[model samples]
Target: MARKIIKTNPNLIELIGNLKDKSYNEEVAIWKDVASRLEKSTRRRTEINLSDINRVSEEEQTIIVPGKVLANGNLDHKVTVAALNFSKTAQEKIEEAGGEGISISEIIEKNPKGSNIKIVE
Candidate 1:
């Protein structure tokens, strides 16, 4: 028997490829985990909210979301967030709270070793 592969969006395929390359080049397992999650079926992909991140994260923490970050609530403190996609309101809210919202690729380039990072979804 062979394992079945799930097809994902083209953009997601590129993201996953980059993540796998970064994981191998940097020897970081977290990147691989993030890549794998992004490879899931679109319906199965991770989708998180600011409130959920607030629940699981601490102030000034670095967090990553493999799918999308939605602006459904408030952020209590400053934090850095990286995600494949962020809602317009989410980006605004993050910055308004003195936090930063960045693309996952940018975060990967800056932190290849994936240190002190929490996967929000």
Candidate 2:
């Protein structure tokens, strides 16, 4: 049987379209890179392990997870994290560290071109 390919959310699709029209060529290239990644392997669902989250640097634009963010690692730096779902412990830990936990859609809305975004699987 062939695997089904899931489509990205309409909001995300719109964001990608906007990104394509950006004036800055470098930014447009970066956005295209991220969009390309998102387009491949349409599983519809995504999950991020907290252990991986802890490895990211604070200076990064933002971390986005398509599925859920778990609470299995220590978060020492203050960084913005946006995802589809977050564990109870993950939410608390992010807030406790002075970081914002938001939805991926919100992140895309704020930074359509993904200018500094680091996507964690």
Candidate 3:
């Protein structure tokens, strides 16, 4: 059977351009990697709730997501979360929890080796 083609979001494209302009190479690489995965239909589609993020321990390095991160769950840990898209509530919650809600580009810049990165959904 042939696989379905997934289209990249325009918003994501613009965001990537901005990251690149800012010289965030790691984030650009990560975004490109995720885009490729989506195109191939090999990337898992998971909906990450806010509660799930909240439950993560502080020891966890970073939470990466290929899809959007919702704000339905609570976050209590002070870990970093990197995703393609983050809802406004989710962003606020993450910040309120003392954690950083960042884009995949930001995470890539911080960890160029791509070590300790987790795909949340």
**How well does model 3 score by local distance difference test?**
0.68
lDDT of 2 by residue, 1-121 (tens): 9865666678666655554555255455655544555555655456666668878656434787756788888778788998767999999988887788997557656876677777776
Cα RMSD (angstroms) for every candidate in the order listed: 1.9, 4.0, 4.8
lDDT tens readout by residue for model 3, 1-121: 9666644777755654554544454443554555544344435555688887666545546888766789996875687888877899888988888888887767757776577666665
Clash pairs, candidate 1, are none
lDDT of each: 0.90, 0.69, 0.68
Q: Judging by lDDT against the true structure, name the best candidate.
A: 1
lDDT of 1 at 1: 100
Quality of model 1 by C-alpha lDDT = 0.90
Model 1 CA lDDT for position 118? 94
TM-score of 2: 0.66
Best by TM-score: 1
Q: How badly does each model clash, as a count of residue pairs?
A: 0, 1, 6
Q: Quick one: RMSD of model 2?
A: 4.0
After superposing candidate 1, which stretches have Cα over 4 Å from the reference? 1-8
Deviating ranges (above 4 Å) for candidate 3: 3-37, 40-44
